[model samples]
Target: MSAGTQRMRAAVWYGAKDVRIAEMDIPAAGRGEVLIEVAFSGICGSDLHEYADGPHAIPVAEPHPASGARAPLVLGHEFCGTVVELGPSVTGLTRGDRVAVEPNYRCGRCPRCRAGEYNICRHFGFAGLMGNGGMAEYAAVPAYMAHRLPENVSLEQAALFEPASVALHALRRAGTTPGTVMVVGLGPVGLLTVRLAAEREVPRIVAVDVSPARLHRASALGATDLIDARLGEGVGERIRELTGGEGVDVAFEVVGSESTLRTCLDATRRGGRVVLVGLAQEMSLDSFALVNNEQSIIASVGYRDTYPELIRLVAERGLDLTPLVTSTIALDTLVPDGFEALLDGPGDQIKILVDLAARSDRLGSPEASAGTRRVRPQPGGGEPETSE
Candidate 1:
């Protein structure tokens, strides 16, 4: 590498439970792409899935068609950063601009992309998992995948745009109307659903979760009723009770479990819609109520084009996402303080951000101008796990 060129550090995923911090040349912005210096990268459920039970969304043996890259992937999808460079033919963005990444890369010729439902494009691929990602000090991404962040949205909170947009898309998929709504499971997506639903002025919003800390956060985010899933059999009853026995107008199942799906069905009135936002492989359901009661089951994936509006919501509508981030760590400490802490489970952590510039920022050093640097995993940090 030339002395003028800088080497970047990244959290590279070799396989499930195997992520390493290695040094690499800073990526160059390709045609119709931009090079981003990542500010904050969030450890998403999908990242956790890769760490816990992965090679699921991430490509392993072969390269993905859309991303055209395979294993030893740089793993991170939800993140925000500054545009450090722009490539040929790219427009509407300049260097030094702050932005959040949508991360969804689609084949434009696909049916879904042509129909404006690109989230479900036949060749759908994610940047972080399928290709180069923001876990590193820098990443070069297609311009379409980048959305400018508003001035009011902090770089830290900008990391939340992707997840919050997922919640917004779930609401859109559910065709959420102004009425009673219940969001089951207070994970990041569920909590954001509650917050967005409140912003949309849903008359009654209910949040359900087993975590008291999450429930408290939900209440603070504007959920009118809180149901503890620990209450077991009585959970659905309490939801129905809060809705005056007729049940909710719309029920969102953010926890994609058999019981949570059942709770969604039982808590919605006849002919109401039930939206499934959580990532669950298989779920069992009662056919009688599903068919007889005429409940509509809607499944939501990542997101469509919800970023611009979400940015506007944050900038103009007073949407507060500050509470979502419970912890922040440096890139070198991602495994111990970021991923492992989240994996240790049932803790008070809602969202953890890996500040790519944390160490460099503190030292007043130009991260990209620095030469190659490598950071190996800690003793217990690299042991592979068998779950997702």
Candidate 2:
């Protein structure tokens, strides 16, 4: 079939709370790009933010400097797929190669990009947010963004590599070691933080969250202490109590709220570091306390050159990521079952994946038999008892 005539289903973002599953012409892989048949696309916190209150990153008034993509585009960055076609000049990849999409777009000439820190490029944008993304039957992404996966890592597990990279990058940015650490959010990234910190054998891991289920999950993932934020007890004070008044050597604020930011700052020791991993807008800071404590606040954005190492961690090191994936749904139910589900019951779900193949089977497509499948989390080490 001709590319222009081939129609694919996509979840297009029009505006806040307005995402339509429409049939659009399949995109052709341009120079240095690859066309992929999307397997699974996971709903991200950023996607939820865009759904709740946005145009935050989706450019509407003007074109983004990097991807030059605007709204009315597909909305998914965390995804994995199989290569269907290779674009001109694309090398080192071939058809049938299973890969995870990195989805980051940056201007190569930017100062940060030139300095090997493309994650914070001056004209930084993401493929799913700024342009077309993987929330469709097929997506064409830059070849460099596609990281070939190991045979052991299922596509469903690979779908989570993006957020896992975020957690890994945050931990690396904080220079985490065998020390007391506090994670002030029990979302996917926060839970992943606990898991990775446990892998690193951080001596004391304090997990703070409002949900008892999430806190229990943290404990199973290796948190030494759990603090319930819903009880109205001061998180900072509780953290202090857990640390015997010395405060944690490092803290991670993953909630992206003013109060959580303050809690992280107050929970950190005098010379400790607080890594800001969440996206927030116009938050007030306690400058006096910050100065008095001589504490450092380090901000970590999207990952850079992390896919290779992350792949090894999962493939070679036996690092299990299935615990973070709480449920999976078809693309047609993305709004209600994926977006609205996360918003309505934020504590109950961690990651909701859109199984394109399930929808394909329902549509009775020729590829239905060969549709992508989900890998169940193996028993032990914080794996949830049940998943859809």
Candidate 3:
């Protein structure tokens, strides 16, 4: 059914430790953009960071150059939705199509964009981070940023495209293929990394985490071994034991803590790569060890050109990542049941999906349904307008 209203319920981030479920005017499909009715959105570590100790990526003091949106912005980046309306000049997509948003908007004039490394675009900004995010009933996104979801992929599974792409890109950036690998921190990214590692033909995957639940999930995802971080400081020694004292071929540090980075470096053999996927402010590393071992520390940022590959993996490679999802809640329950629950670090919850279409009696307010206005498509000679 077509979306008949213009108002949407969004989880807006006002400040640190503050996210309110508020009703706002639905954004229209601008030139070369598509109006999407969000189906499922996954809460990310970045979102949690914004909630806990933020103003990190979310523009608070000033409006983002690309989005022109400031704080009180909608917050969610990992999401999949159905195309409800198409803006001018959009091609290869139609209304009712299921899609996963890449979310990042880049300045094509940048050197990085010209080099096909738009992930690091100098003026880079994300949908939910700077502008209209997916934690809402609807979002408007650039057509170029949307990837068509495969027939076999569910919206729930598609919501993982962003994180899975990050995992894949990190592995690709580290240039490690089939080998014994170690993934430190079995959170959503780490768990997904384990699965992607298996898909890449990595023979052995050692997963380390403090949560038994997350470690169990890693094992279920084909991790050859699991380590409980609480077990002590001998994690590297244990990994060496598992790899017969040679250590893993490559280690991915997903936790971004100094201790975890140390563990990853110690567990890796000479000349092996340590891929840092997580973001942390400070880390103290042993420079001598890194230099002497000829180990390269590769820092991975957001993904670039990974959506198509991820979609193909889900559709054809028999990759079953549905186990990563722990809960599915409606928009109203997002604060208590979604964000707060995740912040509490419930050991069992890996990924939580917010189903926008789910009805909630608690979502009743005069303003809740207030911002509805129909937008007429721009008239032209059937030509798509060009917009940056």
Candidate 4:
């Protein structure tokens, strides 16, 4: 390695509230890898859990069993970038291809991975959680992890595929398609679910949220009806009222709080499906209700093979993420002081984009490269693309 390949800048977390925006090595792409110039990275709610609380059930600094990345590590899983170089054994990918990464880097040899349930492999680990994800200027990922975007997708829109895939994965788990579904909690995941349901032509979407800001955001994102859980009124009753007193075909528990969980149970119809996707504070379900309702409860993990479709839904059909993205900041804002703002900022913000193009002049964005892609104005509560 040359001295020129010494280091680059990254925001690393040593421990709780100990993340430092310091310089680290700009990694070289090894065999079967590709070095990507990260264009945009979204700060996840999961990252907040690690920042505000303890080590997110993942202990202090160590190399991820999957990616072999050790701590103090860079923290960001949701990001989009372009392939600048490919390592030996990497094929069919080259420079300047805009792509979104699948953050789950599991050992393909594991039982679950071999069986096509790679999300739960024995060596299962996430990009930001277990290893160095896309927070840095450049990330060397497996060549296979790169899913190229269509000519229509922007880098910032592509960055959203990571979380959007999660929602799609959950909706698939719940078998929710073209039906009246109830999504509890209008955070990033919940809001995405509402939009996905809308795009999929789901008839009625009842969005439930404690925050009035989130309720308004949900309504803006294609929710047919909104219920303010903080109104201190019975949320389940409102959900039932919205659903014609029959409850919904499927219920998505996006908020893992105790009260939200209860509302999830109360809002679903008999023999309905309940998809538990969010991490819970406390998980205890009543045995009596479980037997009586006979609800098919499904717990979905990250995702499996949904990136291409997720991107297509946004790029081709023009999914609306603008309402979700309440703020956008440059790369310098992602460091020292920006970290706090990312954590403690407004609840109305569904998504916050880190513009890598503004920071790295040499490494340009996917949008800036060709100028062929175009985003049109959205319809009622639909998406509108970014422009100069």
Which candidate leads the pack in lDDT? 2
How do all models score by TM-score?
Answer: 0.91, 0.90, 0.91, 0.87
Q: Write the per-residue lDDT of candidate 1 for residues 109-143, one digit (tens) a residue.
A: 98889999899999898899899788988988899
Off by over 4 Å in 2: 1-5, 176-178, 360-388
Which tens-of-lDDT digit does each residue in 256-308 have in candidate 2? 98989889988899989999998788799989999999999999988998899
- List the candidates ranked by lDDT, beginning with the highest: 2, 3, 1, 4
- What overall lDDT goes with each candidate model? 0.84, 0.85, 0.84, 0.76
Each candidate: how many clashes? Answer: 3, 0, 1, 1
Find the 10 residues in a row with the least total lDDT in model 1.
364-373
Per-residue CA lDDT of model 4 for 168-234, tens digit only, reads 8998887637367888877788889888888888888888877888888778778888887775448
RMSD to truth, every model = 5.7, 8.9, 6.6, 10.2
TM-score of 1: 0.91
Candidate 4: C-alpha lDDT: 0.76
**Model 3, 89-203: lDDT tens per residue?**
9999999999999999888888999999999999898899988799998899889888998789888779998989889898898783847899999989999999988888788
Better of 2 and 4 by lDDT: 2
Clashing pairs in 2: none
